[model samples]
Target: MGNFLIVSAGQSLREALSVAENNGVDPKAVLDMLTTAPTLFPSPIYQGHGKRIVEDTQAAPFRQRKIPLKDVSLFTKTAQQVELSTPIAHLLSDLLRSDEARA
Candidate 1:
């Protein structure tokens, strides 16, 4: 659960780091390691959140598949309601909607 929250809320975390840095705080050491997990336990976390599988349910071909963005609009709306800046959520929502429009 902790890993999910920390890894999934990437956009919000970046915004937080920006705010912290602007206020003369330094947390580069902590921020630098979010990309990959430890060598021992690497596969599971990546397979779940970071993998972009073929979205067969969509009309597009296998080559056209993208990351499965789970209900980004609802998630972003909730983020806004909570005064959170989730730029990734908005971007994913826009991308998904545009893809739908293209189909």
Candidate 2:
């Protein structure tokens, strides 16, 4: 949910909401919908140790490549273009870039 909050402030979400608003969708109504939606994860973990950690370590390099930095950069770029604030997203993106394990 917290991550979603960050994502919701990112470029992709900013662009999407702009489109929604252009189509007669009210921004406040969209937020209200979210407030009314059922919660899927009562408690969510951002980082988790999965069952195959040992096995997964062998493919760590490949795994890192699979994470979409392109999307994140694009999101940040679009946020700037749209004049929307995305501090959290930008922070996450910066952290992602610096993490050698992820990079």
Candidate 3:
């Protein structure tokens, strides 16, 4: 799916856990309920972190977006540069690669 799936899923999961907690349901029970869904957790990938690739091309955008200046002191007169780490960088790269790509 187009990147937002993971973010929306996270928000939904947080809300679910909050509700469960409010009703005194154990958090582990909530995770157990999720694992029972065949479609979402068909395999054991949920038990551990999944391996993924990070190709040189994938890192290209980060290199291109690198800040030129070094970090300056808080009270210094010089302007400082800040770097951000986006969780959906790979998805963003795919989305921005073409002119006709739909979001």
Total clashes in model 3, counting residue pairs 3 or more apart in sequence or in different chains = 0
**Superior candidate under TM-score, 1 versus 2:** 2
| Candidate 2 clashing pairs, residues 3+ apart or interchain | none
TM-score of each: 0.38, 0.39, 0.36
| Model 3: per-residue Cα lDDT over 1-103, one tens digit each | 3223332233345445557767898755665666555645433432221111012222321122212111111112221233434444433333333312331
7-80, model 1: which lDDT tens digit per residue? Answer: 34533444444565577765353343443465332454433222222122132222231333444555766778
Q: Residue by residue across 1-103, what tens digits does model 2's lDDT show?
A: 3333433333333344447667898744443443333632222221111111222433422134224445566777777897989786676576556653544
Candidate 2 root-mean-square deviation in Å: 15.0
Worst 10 residues of 1 by lDDT: 53-62
Task: Please report how far candidate 1 places residue 53 from its true position, in Å.
Answer: 4.2
TM-score of predicted model 2?
0.39
lDDT of 2 at 32: 40
